[model samples]
Target: MRYVVQVFASAFRIRKIVNDGEFCILYSDSDPSIDCIYVTDKWILSNQAKPGGYYIAYDNGDSEYVEEDEFKMRATFVDQD
Candidate 1:
């Protein structure tokens, strides 16, 4: 049950959930130390840094849009190696 950690332009840490055993699109990005009970049947994912910025996105059909969300890919960070 691995997870993804994204570094955005903000100072706060960003967490997002990724896929599961079935390879369904349950992707997300969140803090790395967040190890706890996931009590949701759904997943919330983040977005890639865009022209202005980035944000988190989800698809549970509970939004006022009532449609699929349009979000960018995952944001990336480079380690000094």
Candidate 2:
């Protein structure tokens, strides 16, 4: 069996698994119109800390800024059971 990993960037972006692990590493992108953040696959969970990076996976690749909100953007690494 095969499993695909994904990264939910924001509201408009979803990146595929470029790397694998509890600490996945992916590319990061940014837009210049909205008050948003760009993230990369390179990430870690709250309890864990890896490298620092981000990507604008969603948001139509535009700079349409909006109020700050929180979403449970998460990633995990473990041998499937």
**Backbone clash numbers for all candidates listed:** 9, 16
- Which one wins on TM-score? 2
lDDT on C-alpha atoms for all candidate structures = 0.29, 0.32
**TM-score per candidate, chains pooled:** 0.17, 0.18
Candidate 1 regions off by >4 Å? Answer: 1-32, 42-72, 78-81
Alpha-carbon RMSD to native, per candidate = 13.9, 16.1
lDDT at residue 37 of model 1 (Cα atoms): 20
Per-residue error (Å), model 2, residue 51: 15
Q: What is the lDDT of residue 53 in candidate 1?
A: 25
- The positional error of residue 77 in candidate 2, measured at the CA in angstroms, is 34
**1-81 per-residue lDDT for model 2 (tens digits):** 999975333432222224443334433222234442333333333313222333334434532212123222342222322
Please give me the total number of clashing residue pairs in predicted model 1.
9
